[model samples]
Target: MILPAPIPDRVDVVIFGGGVAGLWTRWRLEHAGYSTLLLESSSLGHGQTIASQGILHRGTKYAFGKDVSQASMELLMAQEVWSRAIKGVDGPDLRRVTVLSPTTVMWTSESFLSRFTGAVAAGVLKSDVKKLEGDARPAAFKSAPKAVNVWEIDEKVVDSSTLVRELARVVRGPMASLAPDAHTHWDLPGMLSWTDAAGRSHATHASAAVLCAGVGNESLITSLAGTTSVPGAAASHVSQRRPLHMVMMRGAPCDLFGHCIRELSDKPRLTVTSARDADSFVWYLGGSLAEDGVSRDESTQIDAAKLAVHECLPWVDVSRASWATLRVDRAEGRTATGKRPDTPIVSHIAAAGHTLAVWPTKLALAPAAAGRVFDLLETAGIRPTGVIDAGEPALSPAPLPWNEGGVRWR
Candidate 1:
């Protein structure tokens, strides 16, 4: 319902950032018949997305042997979207990943298993479930394991770099070109003010601007007028949850394809997860103030990755460090008891005439966020959801994850 703006040369919907969310947004918008223009300050996907261990969550996050909830339902749908997008645009070299290499997921405590199992028995797990089994050991964890009822599934791993490259090819399309006009720096560096090497800026005539800048959205705190509000995150919790992540060039022996595991921390409610890719293992520490920024030393974290994985591979080459990026996972609308909050979307920058901010990786939760943003644009009479939100988090904009350091699309 966006009222037609003053005559502009192009109504290109400018998305900032070139990460998964930005690329996904471009795909969604273009497919929906919108003339979209994407701008990446660096290249594409030199940031957090490439550092991923490639465990495309198919709603199996906390649902090891349990049922899929509303969140899981949306996540499954997102996975399908990811699956289709990857299959459609990905090249053979890019898609050449260790497909279906098995792994195990375990919970140390039986009590937690009881709750998880109880949820499954009660049909909570079957709602959006593709499959659910318990008390069975996959050969991977069966060789010698201390846990029970390890569940495994047929999921996919993304060579994120390849995925990004294919996505870039698809979205850039034959006609898409470097936006050759000097972009207006709308009080920001990358997204709002993107002007590719050709110098073209974003179209200001759009009904609303979508901020896919990731944690860098802080750059828009000025646009939002003041600081953003964090409901349940605090300094102590964030520090306690501060994680150290590393990637070992040492070549792990484990078959990590389509496998992800989380080890709950000794500290109550804290956890760090790991997923092994063909190249290395990706370590993620959570249950702290992921939103307020990490309290741990970034370099030390990398060292820890070396040491932990070094135990598994003594000859690992510590010299060639693969790509790494620092990020604080933000959550929204925490429960009163304060566990990891489910699916988040913050609407309106209070006074900004027409802008929306989001954590793009939370694609499972983005359908809701996008609906809200589009609703706002609808108030201004602009309609852009022609492709519709198929429960995917493809909102709007390109990310900074891709860079020249590695052709993320490669």
Candidate 2:
């Protein structure tokens, strides 16, 4: 049975945010004997964690112009780390986690560009991609036209909700809720205090603090540092937003976990993953469709999804499918060109006191982010203190994004 935990007067570390990055960091630090407290403004996975398509990318999508860039190598390393964790060999044991698909398929139309992409992928990721013959293809593609080509790639898909639940089960911190507009203060010597909505002021002393709150990190850093930007003699903190409009379809004809490749594009034309509700199969779409959908209205986006699906999968009947759209922003360290960062971003602001701000560019890179945090703490000479057993109750877990009830269907 679970027990209540009271606020401790002190801790070795204080974490802000309950998402994957925050939870993973807590797990790692606590394992080393550090006392920790996690403060959450809302339910866990309420943001990008739940909004994601749950794809464990394998760098196939980032390959461009016959070369594998730093982004591609980072994804390959992430895959290795995640594979060990999922297999319970190293890191957290995720053996019980739900894996929606063990592998994903990549298919393309019969065209010059399409053939070129297949060749580049084959040369770059030779062992990772396998071409199938007539009878070896999946049933969904049996009805496809003669000109279509299909290849299987080594990428896995997981149930985001299930993954979050498993991570929460292993977290060691006493998770607590923070009021929407709670007032928080930080002092020079590592003292932190906050005023809850009930007008009760709680204070805690920590050796250090970390922020894994994604976009919310901006305001929190500004408020605590008393400046719009965190400026240090060594480094400065800045963030950028990349938004996506994702489409979801219920009652799909079949369960498909794959990507549709097009000629002359570095990204997939359509990326699809399937999950089951009580009675029907649901399809989640990402990739180029989601990135481009950001500029279109809801109705127009849904119509566009229908056309894309029909064009890509001629055998599927989408006329009876019900559609919905979800918009989410990806937070990352700002780049000179304002493009997405290839690797996770972790920044330390000595000028702002004992604080570290982190952004895991992709869900697959959570392990890498945690490793960076660990390195930062070690570099600062911060050691784990004894664990604290505060008697306060645990914070409630965040509901799945789909459960929030704001999904608009047309």
Candidate 3:
């Protein structure tokens, strides 16, 4: 469709969006030894990548209950995401080393645990499933057997932004160039910069392009060539169920000897996570506070969030707690029956013929997702993994069960 011709056509790839999906795509593509150029409408990590709750998501959390359909769609696959991040790339500067510590996550009911077991049988859940009869450990969740059942698993909190920066550095090389604090315009098989606060503009080109923009997929579709139309409504699903996680840090240990995964206050729609970050203990609270695009007022939202976070963990004095609010929009198509479209929706603009359109779970799938796109390019076809949804379903497929007296993690 009107790709820039100034740069040589030999360029292998052009990537849009500079967050986890985009940057990770850049890193993996460069390592695969293809000449690549990355462009973004705004600065990198301006999207959800930075807003992530910071869990390498073990996929174990998906073991909610018996609904295999929901569990399969929700399968953490994060294990793979984390695994690849640490594999193949090894250097002191690279985040090759990851720390996994013992943490306990509990579901208060056996009925819920049974649903989880059914999910495992359906391949939706991925973890060691056990049902217990008595109190669990971690000192935090330990209680009478009927009170709770905990699954002690390995979890790690890697530096998400640092991960992206490292990937960018690796892509650019030791003496390579970077255009941080820059804006880009995609003009099919290329990039054009008209102007910025810095003034003046420049142009560059590439062979193929990947649109890694998450919620901003709409703008990319309108501007870039080969991008198919992804209606604005679908993209905003994430913003519709916006949850604000306020992580209040105070009196957290000097060292993060391990991580904590307590069951924060309940929100049927979202997950609120509290754990020890770096040098401070954090009380993270979030859920479906905002529904269908009508989010809470910031001042009021902050107050409500503080109270919720403090309820579960009293150590965090909301008044004295230092805080940061992380917001993320859910993008799944829906969650009623837990059925997403069997395939992800990808569009190619025949006019520009260089850009591509993608949405939904595409963010969670990142690098491997990119690799699949590259393969499709070589074969002149598309292979979609799954569609998007807004937030977790009310009754997600139950994963394997874990509690007192049913079984153990031996």
Candidate 4:
């Protein structure tokens, strides 16, 4: 844990979230010689980041439809940016972050539509995937029936918790944690006030204040928008939440990271990622299962997930597995049709001062979010001021979902 330090009264930027996007933006700002202070109401990545399946999507999954959509192309660019960063080029050096899988497998069921979608996706993403058959197949599919088709796609899975810690470590500034009951009051141009553990209130000022809190951004944006005098500032950007009922299974049959593709949908049927849970491993399930499962209660979702696992991977035995469910919201900038935004969005509130609302949309596009903030800062003529000596790190990374206690698995 980072020892407490006296919160600086001023800095270059005051970021309001400690998730991937917030922490990443902090790292970028500090590296560019700007002083930053990050404030989190809870442990880092508590809701969205840690719950993410950590798939660095390459837009291949988006090609299962009739044609590649704009979201697919945006993710393709994000994939390239992240891949380069992972290799210690172009962006932040993520070599120290743990990679759960270098590549992910995409498998098609015996259904004709599933096979057809898989074939079309292969053609569209030819350079990113390669077919595997017989002895070339990974052990996870060794027992697969002849009708099943599997291909390895170039996508990297990461330990989101580790990435959060790494980003915090490199930020080289103070990160403050607000008391659970503490409320933040924002002022023009970068002033933030909050109560501390001892009931002491502290306030800091910066050149810019960025709202990076995921769902929390909703209320914060509402508050800021309510006070802004700029025309259409309230409507300039809005936040939306797309809820997901993700399933988790402990004591999974095997370590597998892949997506099960089916017909009539552009999204993967089931996207599974493996992560260590103590001495054993757990499989975090997402994609269509999570999306469609949103309406399902806990028990119903678990039952549906069990059926999905059995149906998708008939070769694997999961009699001893226990299951649980996590309900999370995919927070992003609201689009015209309530669809996912194609890229990171940064909105300048300019409410009496430089206040901005930011949403990376996807975890892989965090760097792009930072880039957007940078462009805004540059365009506004905000230069790097002297760094604030925050003494020691002040915040800690949040626990992963599987590691968090009190989960009642069945």
Q: Give each model a TM-score.
A: 0.58, 0.92, 0.63, 0.94
Candidate 2's C-alpha runs over 4 A off are: 1-4, 65-67, 134-136, 196-199, 227-237, 389-393
Off by over 4 Å in 3: 1-10, 65-78, 87-104, 107-136, 139-146, 173-197, 224-279, 288-294, 310-346, 360-364, 381-410
How good is model 2 by TM-score? Answer: 0.92
Q: Which is better, 2 or 3, measured by lDDT?
A: 2
| Best of the two (1, 4) by lDDT | 4
**Candidate 4 local Cα displacement, residue 337, angstroms:** 1.0
lDDT of 1 by residue, 190-214 (tens): 2344444445443334445565555
User: What global local distance difference test value does model 4 have?
Assistant: 0.82
Tens-digit lDDT track of model 4 for 1-410: 65787788888888888999998888778778888888888888877998999988887787766546776777888888888777888567787889999999999887787888788778877898999899877677889898888999988999998888777776578888777656667765657788876678899887888889998877676666676565655633677778999999999756889999888577888899998766767999998899999999999999999888877887788889999999899888878778778788887766637777888988988888888898888788778886666665677777778777877889
lDDT, model 2, position 268 = 84
The per-model lDDT (C-alpha) reads 0.41, 0.78, 0.43, 0.82
Tens digits of per-residue lDDT, candidate 2, 341-379, equal 889988875656668888889998888898899888888
All candidates in order of TM-score, best leading: 4, 2, 3, 1
- Model 4 per-residue lDDT at 219: 67
Estimate candidate 2's alpha-carbon lDDT, on a 0 to 1 scale. 0.78
Candidate 4 residue pairs in backbone clash = none
Could you tally the backbone clashes for each prediction?
A: 28, 9, 39, 0
